[model samples]
Target: MPVDHYTYRVTWSPEDNEHVGLCAEFPSLSWLARSPDAALKGIRSLVAQTVADLRENNEPVPEPLAEKRYSGEFRVRIPPEQHRALAMQAAEQGVSLNRLVSMKLAA
Candidate 1:
């Protein structure tokens, strides 16, 4: 039940006028503070509390994104015109469409 590996991020929140911390595993939970460090700590503390509560209640806990396995393959749909454009670009670059898309995405 370790939560340290859970994906965490801190960013400025325009609406709240403060830094906000977010956890990927628990999207519904967040912490707002005046500083990024405080925001991060607050979210981590909140997550620990939430995890303890969940375990106490016998509720299922979410798997951390870092602990999940990915196959490196997923399908994405785009407009036919965009598809054709990418295909043409891939051909011109002497690469497969998948490779072209992967390079673009990586960039």
Candidate 2:
């Protein structure tokens, strides 16, 4: 039987606008994006690279991620006044709320 595995949740604080970031609850790896879409893309790429590295070094592959499809979560808070502006940007770029906040923070 294949073993079931769990993914860690990464959280970011919206309290500080100057230095926002995504941190994995388990401290695996973190990446910065200019938008939620960018961040999502970055995370996906990171995981794929990690897998390739593991295989190249002949390291034991972790279950769950090693065999199944994976998805991650990203969250953010926005002020009521900025909702319209943010929505427009997200629609224009076709990204998520978490990504937009991350990208703005990164910039």
- Candidates' lDDT values, in order? 0.96, 0.56
Candidate 1 per-residue C-alpha lDDT over 1-107 given as tens digits, one digit per residue, 9 for 90 to 100: 58898999999999999999999999999999999999999999999999999999999989999999999999998999999999999999999999999999999
Query: Listing every candidate in turn, what is its Cα RMSD in Å to the true structure after a full C-alpha superposition?
Result: 1.6, 14.9
Specify the poorest-scoring 10-residue window by lDDT in model 2: 17-26
Best candidate according to TM-score: 1
Give each model a TM-score.
0.87, 0.40
Which segments of model 2 are wrong by more than 4 Å? 1-26, 65-107
Q: Residue 43 error for model 2, in Å? A: 0.8
Q: Which residue pairs clash within candidate 2? A: 34-103, 35-99, 35-103, 36-99, 36-100
